[model samples]
Target: MTDIPSSLEDVAEACGTRAALALLAHFEGIDLYFPHNPRPDHPILQALGPEDGPAVCHYMAGETVTIPNRSPAKRRARILALHEQGLSTAAIARKMHQTQRWVREVIRRAGEDDQGDLFG
Candidate 1:
């Protein structure tokens, strides 16, 4: 809720008792107790909010790997193109040098079947 718009124009929320009960249930499931301010640094009453920062990626493994230069949209388009070219998930994974799971996920995220066929 930190970035909630001033007018809530871009927000979608349920507006009744059911919504209140749903929120309470969600908080209970996530262990968010009432009166708890987990992000004390970001008090709700603060006049100014935190600044947007640059995105950073860190390397974990000892092996050196080159990160791709293309943005995510480009990468997803490439995946979809390959899928349209009738490549099997395994074949796409091999051609893209990505895991079969990753290939499947890309297809799924692009609203396609596990077999890489686009769904209407």
Candidate 2:
């Protein structure tokens, strides 16, 4: 019998019930490609010594290839604007939508009242 490489496959193979639950929690209602802004300070990325971080591969509307950060609030806001236009969640879901959960979240965030301004 041959021993497996511990580094690559060990973490995945050792993902027991707790790990599975954690994975579900981490990914639930989140887009892997377009994660929420301000990632939770990834230690690994920091440890990589900061050479502009990992490059993401993305395909844009014009079929152009681009690498973008996980969270681009400008683009997200554009999608939110559409949601605020009385468009159905499904409609918004079809357009800029990556996931239904993400669409709903955008709508919810857009609908929030400007309470912050009142405090100021």
TM-score of 2: 0.35
**lDDT scores for all predictions?**
0.42, 0.41
Model 1 alpha-carbon drift over 4 Å, by segment: 1-63, 66-69, 112-120
The digit string of per-residue lDDT tens for model 1 on 32-57 reads 12222224343221211222100010
lDDT per residue for candidate 2 within 39-80, as digits (tens), equals 446522232223321211111111221222234576478677
TM for every model, in the order presented, reads 0.37, 0.35
TM-score of 1: 0.37
RMSD of 1: 16.4
> What range of 10 consecutive residues in model 1 has the weakest lDDT sum?
52-61
Superposition error at 18 for model 2 (Å):
45
Model 1: per-residue Cα lDDT at residue 11: 17
